[model samples]
Target chain A: MLWNLPGIHVPADPLYPGAPPFLTNTFLLTIVGSILIIALMLFVGRNPKQVPGKLQNLVEWVFEQFLNLCEQVAGPERGRKFFPWVLTIFLFVLFANWWEVIPGIETIGFKSTDTALSPACAHVGSQGFLLFGQYSNCITPFFRPPSTDLNFTIALSIVTVVMTQVYGFVVLGFRLQIGRYLVFNQGIMGFIVGLFELLLEAMRLISLSFRLFGNLFAGDVLLVVISFISIGVGAIPFYFLEIFVGFIQAFVFAFLTLLFFTLGTTPHGHEAHEEEHLAETAHAEHERVASALAGAKLEEAHAQ
Target chain B: MAEHEPHNTQNSRGGGSNPYQGALVAFSLVGQVGLMISLGALLGVFAGLFVDSKLHTTPIATIIGLLLGLAAGIYGVFRLISTFRKAG
Candidate 1:
């Protein structure tokens, strides 16, 4: 049945049994997604024009939207600094998620005939292509969505969290950044709060990784089950749903990264500055309102 | 009316009042809470198991770790909510 859950197989080294090797379906898909992004950027940016064509206009519009979002969330100055990273992350994840919806992604692969290889490969008479003398009931997909894999998402999360810390240190200096996780003063409550903050930081890595992995994996599994139950027709609506979900997930991931970037880059001392700024703005607003009310009263008297 | 105008202007300037942005923020917040709690507990159990194995005290450290994890998870939720509130 096509409804079997995706098996978590340790990718074997194609060369030797104990040889240190690399590259799995997830990695390959990631590489492909990256290449696609690079190609799209090159194609859209090849010609500089006063008025952009359709593809160039589309690409530019997307970038402009993301840039605006970053600026809105992170302020204009820091937004510009982090725009490229956010854009790259969004595009990569967007492509990686969307790639699963393409025809023959998880559906096409060779069957495992060698039962000795693994227990999953023990189904001898099952329907699958004969791949390296192995016959299994189900085919191992050539390209799985990268985000559906825990390893891929964890790697991405690690990089993101590490960058956040790096940016924090750069902006706040080593002492202040360390101070964020460790409190030496302010009594026991302060120390406890600091420990909780540290725990939250660790949890961020887990949350970030698992969120992407769970969403994509669930979607992929749902698609497979639907396709199995009703052939192809019933899965069509779900395919569209998955596309929307893919886009939303990509947006959320990128936006959160941008949010963290903003938070990390803000100095601890800026809280007081921000409060003062807000107070000044409020005072100005109050004066403006008072002046407007006075002007309205004067106009009313003149009319009377 | 005068008092409300500054808040309104500030909201408009912040640009986070849009429905799409709101939805994204809400989704992310939900995911954060769910994962924090579950992963926190799971990590705690594993850590406790490792410690218990080393010290030959099985359930004692495990129970303590689980409680600590639950506390941490609750703290995490509050922290996330406050952060979002501040941002908004």
Candidate 2:
């Protein structure tokens, strides 16, 4: 089942040509998805609407949702500024996500070499890869969801992490960004904690990248497994569940990016108002002690 | 969303010229896949443990499955990273 499944090949043909191992059926979907998104947006918003019809209205709604999401997850200030990025990401991701259901990815590709880049054994199966070229020319699945491809998801994740860091610097500045993990005030304790924070910063790159990939890839594998395990009716519910998961995973990725952006840009000590109060109290105590000692000396001199 | 229009025009090389940007994007894609596999392996281990308890064996079976899953996930991550480095 695993060998005959949808994404077993990177070249799907490993040999048909001197193809790179990175190319696969799943990647075909991602490439098409990106194009589809661009095309859809161009077609839908070609004209500015005063009142707006159904498609226009829907596009506007999604746009509004992404903006609000940015504001909610990021502050209103950054949200307004980053709205473009968040919206583009969501739209591109959403399109990539829903593309698999478009009906051509599985049964529509051409019969090439059946490796990771290809699907099903070319010579043995019933017309392997039906819709495109011999090995992934511009002729593969007219549409494959980008998210299904591990490579595509990882690509998206990496960009997202980079964007987050870029925005962090924009808001915090370089010195402040470094200060977030290089504090020297608390002496050795601060140094240790700072090192931990730095490590976490590096870990964020891995964690963010993997979380999205994990969800999307798992969904893809689940669908393949379910389809293979039971075809007539048993797989129906799982398919529906996969649809729900696809949307949720996309939402989670964008939302988390919003979250990381907010957290990353914020100054560290700003949250600890109580510490400032304590310092003020200590200063007042020193002043009171000094005044009392001066008063005592004056009293002793007068008495003498 | 409207802001995207301006940026798109700026980035529209339209010919896949920005190899560096492409490499970063490709690296990210690999990260996500490795993560998914790692997660899947973790879940598999958990499932194996649940079944193992009934069979009177300890967590050995689950641990083995988990280790295998981790190996696969890590292998995927390395593959993606190496590719990114080569392309870069």
Candidate 3:
């Protein structure tokens, strides 16, 4: 079944003495995911062909679909610019999440002698084999899904939010982008609103990170519990669900990133123009009402 | 709006109006709004704690931070809603 939740604790024993304990199972899994992606890319790029092989065809199809999605979300110009980053994120996240469904991912690892579970409670039984002196349920998993880790998700979010700001500055210029955070024109009210905008910007990091971390971690736990309850058959449907969820989450993350990029790159003047248009409409409505009232008053006078 | 016209046309061509995509967009917006509010408050609390520690004002700074956080949360929700509306 499941070991103690990975990344909940920094392993006391380092992979090598004098090394930091931060090299966690999730970190290892992230490395694995990266390697897999690199290998796939290398395989696809090793030989060029006028016509494509199955693998190349699959890769090309994915690329085309994702590029189309980016174009839809961010226009052709920005979409082409953002295509690589968004695609990389989507592929990495999707692969990382799918790693969880691999058999024995969090189940198989070296047993540790420093377990929190008591020896008496850790005996093998009809339910399942229990190894003593290991972490939760006496099993130390070697790899866990990287997306389940907050650090991984947070790093991705930082990249996203930081790049968004960078693009904003590149498109709108520094003063205008910074103006988004430090509004000063409308006196105290504008200043207050600016502070809120600033806070909201900061909160994007948490939002992006927590959404990925929460979903993957919860799914991992759910799978473990389900498997523990019913060993094989019952867990199959859940695995399929996780697979679907993994794809959806990856798409959502990429789509949201594209959306943020589009929003960020848009000049503040556009919003101001919309506001002006709204004001103009309101004024026109007022004028129409006033004219109607005036005509009604003139008719009453003429009747008198 | 002129710039976005091509993008809109592309989306229409690609069947972007599918109910599933609409649901996903809605879900993303709602989740983002919720996270922004909670995290804003949490960040404010941390900021307040740091300020209190530095200034020895204790709960006053924390209370002010909490209020500011609430305002920020509400503003964030409005901004997100407007952004999605504009995008859609």
Candidate 4:
């Protein structure tokens, strides 16, 4: 069953004319997603029971897992400080990305006669859907995943990087944090190194934003292509894959946020101490593995 | 069998880290290292071009920027790998 798919466009389609250029499908979804998240959190948290219901149980489970992770990664004090920011990012991105799998997200839209935007024929197919054989290419979807939009991802990344810098200054104070980027005390090579550090920070922003955008956009295209090739059945596997991708991307984003927060807040002297701690941890792990292996060997010899 | 207790307390996993944490860190770092190098070079080239426009030294600044960016990216990769190595 061949279906005419809309031309895959990089930019999000505006929902209506004269509604301001920023009122694209992705923007609409962003607002809706934010409200949904806030409402869900409030409803679940408003009345707490000694014994939680299914909804509350799920919410609490997610929170506990992430809270543990934050504490483990950034230590108790800083992790507690950074928990809310990390959790908010994880939840928002997770839901926003999960929107892709919803039925009629890209399919349900008005057939536009605007030839400039949608040049295909406006005629609906006999099946009564706008995206029929020749008519499918012109439908402007009312809902698109916010993650697929560069604007949304870039804006989110800007917030993340800026907040990281803010945390750095807050925790490390002006002199130490500013010294990270501008090393005037040392000679020209140190100055050059500082410039490189500044450039690397810019690179972090670009990488963070584009990594998310590229993955989600590619996943969106993959789903469309798979569906186009093998009706609906072939798309099932891809749907599951997309779901997994959505979760993973959200997780990676959150983890990166937490990491950046940790790095930004940590002073240079503290970083050296952390490295020493890490070395100690590695040494301990090696000893534990060696002992386990030795015990396993002894058991095998005894059995033989 | 005794019923498992709910982990109501933090750091109650007997000092054992989350299994998924290592995997995720590795996954993210793989993407991160490659991206840092490529984007570093790209940012360098763009900055060079901008300077070239003002200074009227077209290719010279661009070349210098490209080299510096490449070096910075390599340094960054090494730094990341060392950190990972120590942690592991």
Candidate 5:
């Protein structure tokens, strides 16, 4: 995103002047986030170590956290199968979220050319910035965190929804896959469940997409507002806060994706089965109580 | 023992509470918004059809308009969904 961006040299806005194309702030952040993530993984996983070193250890620890998260939802066996997805999601989002925290990144943009050309950089015989490189930096793109982009978040959410369905197909056959959500072929109940199922899947997409987009976008907007009010120093504290929010949002997105994957594979509406279980359990308890009472009476009679 | 209550589920009941239930609710609200947006889009296309029909263009105009409106609605809905349903 840094390579291409929300720069003055380019259109000030990512969206076309009239069109609501994209919010550029988001696009650039996602790119930078992607680049950093790729670079970090390559660097950390560079050398294969039997004993292990700091880089290897850190990577391993990160994997350990991811694994535990997967296990919580997918369980021991299924989680391992689902590890790759969970890990990928965490890394992508984590990097995007964390990218904004690096200081000097957001503030460190070249002065706008218009501002420089007006009376600003034109200090009488300023000699036109002297160096050619100086002129280029005049409208350089600003580096912001990637998660801050709505496009990136939406893209991730879409991928998450797709995975849930794929897993559903994998675990439940094509027929059950239909049965799991639609139930239309069977009857009204199935149809209702199907509609509800459709709605639930839709919810996953919305929740996963909007939560990340809303949080990150809000953070960026807040930071922008703060910078305007108090200048660079004022936005300092918020930058740190953004980092924390990024971590949480990323974790939540990944975790929910994992949970949804688990649920999509399960069949629709079994509320009655649950009720039946409760009744059986209560009956068993009553039987035990009756048996105990009978034993007590027998014991008393024998003693007499 | 006190903390670990045996709140077990029935055999037919698939393990834990439906994992996607929360996702279902959240996605439903957003999806409904999307649905409404498409519905409005369809209304526009159909309104155009009414103009054609009023001019006495029978069957041809009506059929064309119906098909076009349906196509527009389906396209909008599918497009919105496709973005959110890419492969993992």
Candidate 6:
């Protein structure tokens, strides 16, 4: 029996009729992902325990890990301030990427009625399933991961970049922050550099969004192609690779966001140099302690 | 424990709270370098195209925009490297 190869849609299909076209499968999945995160947070945070249960312990460990990351990268005060934003971004992105690995997500959907397919190859099932066909893609999957959609990634990137600007204003005040892009007193070279910086800020909106979107979208296509070539046999390793890729992409998004926040909040000129120096020293000290702890744990394990 | 010592120290050197964060930055950095450059050129061309449409200069603005965008992308990559250097 021939397996029906699914069609890849760059723009998400609307989940239902009579609604806005923007209410696509990707949009619904994003909302579902958000609600899941919220519910998990609420369930975990409902009661505080002196000694955490398994669920609470897992959540706390994740929280502490990110908290340490923030403090290490951004300095103590700024890191603490930026922690919530960094954590939220990480969790949201992580879920979105992981959803790609779920079995039926992009695979299970109704046969497309509108997409023009050759009558010779197209076989629509009794229940509207696109069954065993030479056609590559005839089914419109009910769910597509949010990262697979350019819109979702672009929206997230814009929010992150805008928040960086907001943080700049909050930390360095209006004059200093605005001065970053428009420097009159710094001479022609400085002026050009400032312009480049401004252009780079706009370019980040593209870079951040496209990076996540490209990686995940390509992964989806790869899976479909690989599965098509050799059926189930060749796709196993790629699925595992997708899981790893998913996590790394999520981590990169969050880490970059944290870095941008740090850059945004930092004051310019001599103060910038001084603050960086201090943050570096503190970060080094933290690393030393972490290394020492790791060594101790290793030694204890050896002794046992 | 002895075998793991190097791995643990390496994690610390990588500059994350865990090994996952430290090592993955290298992976992310490589991807970032390529993406930054392309995006820079792409943005430049788009802006150039817009200006050309407005002023009817055709490809002249587009060419200049491409050069400037490429340059901006290179500069952006430089900043990214320095930032990571400072970070790690």
lDDT of 4 by residue, A192-303 (tens): 8778777767777888788889999999999888887787679998899999999999988998888778767766534567977999999999999999999999999999
Q: Which candidate is the best by lDDT?
A: 6
Ranking the candidates on lDDT from highest down gives: 6, 4, 3, 1, 5, 2
Q: Estimate each model's TM-score.
A: 0.77, 0.60, 0.76, 0.83, 0.59, 0.81
What are the per-residue Cα lDDT tens digits for candidate 1 across A149-245? Answer: 7788888889998999988887778987887678877677667767766777778787777788878888988887787668669999999999999
Encode model 6's per-residue lDDT on A43-88: one tens digit a residue. Answer: 9999969999999989988888888788877777888899999999
The residue-level lDDT of candidate 2 at B81 comes to 47
| Local error of candidate 5 at residue A217 (angstroms) | 1.3
Pairs in clash, predicted candidate 3: none
User: Where in model 4 is the C-alpha error above 4 Å?
Assistant: A116-131, A269-304, B1-10, B13-16, B53-58, B78-88
Compared with the true structure, what per-residue lDDT tens digits does model 2 show for residues A1-304?
2233344322222212454675655666556767878888898879868998898888876776666555544556886777887677766777777665544455454344435445333433444333323333212333345665556766777787778778878998998777767889878766755654554444455566556556666666666567656752566786677677666666666655655566666555543356567888999999999999999999999999
> How high is the CA lDDT of each candidate model?
0.74, 0.59, 0.76, 0.81, 0.61, 0.83
1 against 6, candidate with superior DockQ = 1
In Å, residue A103's CA in model 4 sits off its true spot by 0.9
Tally clashing residue pairs in candidate 1: 5
Instruction: Write model 3 residue lDDT over A1-304, tens digit each, in one string.
Output: 3333332332222333344668877888888899999999999989958899899989987887777767656677888898998999999999989998999887676554433543433443323444422234545567778888888898899999999999998988988898887887868978888788778767877778888888988888888777766754688999999998898888778877877787778665446689779999999999999999999999999999
Q: By summed lDDT, which 10 consecutive residues of candidate 1 chain A come out lowest?
A: A10-19
lDDT of 4 by residue, B1-88 (tens): 6498746454664434567767877798888888878877887788889999999999999998888888888766765565445334
Residue B50 lDDT, candidate 2, scale 0-100: 80
What's the TM for model 6?
A: 0.81
- Give per-model CA RMSD: 6.1, 14.9, 7.4, 7.6, 10.7, 9.6
For residues B29-88, write the lDDT of model 2, one tens digit per residue.
Answer: 554565546564665587568868888677777886576556545543543344334323
Q: Assign candidate 4 its CAPRI class.
A: acceptable
Which residue pairs in candidate 1 collide? A112-A134, A112-A135, A113-A134, A113-A135, A114-A134
Interface Cα RMSD per model, in Å? 3.6, 14.4, 2.9, 2.8, 11.3, 3.8
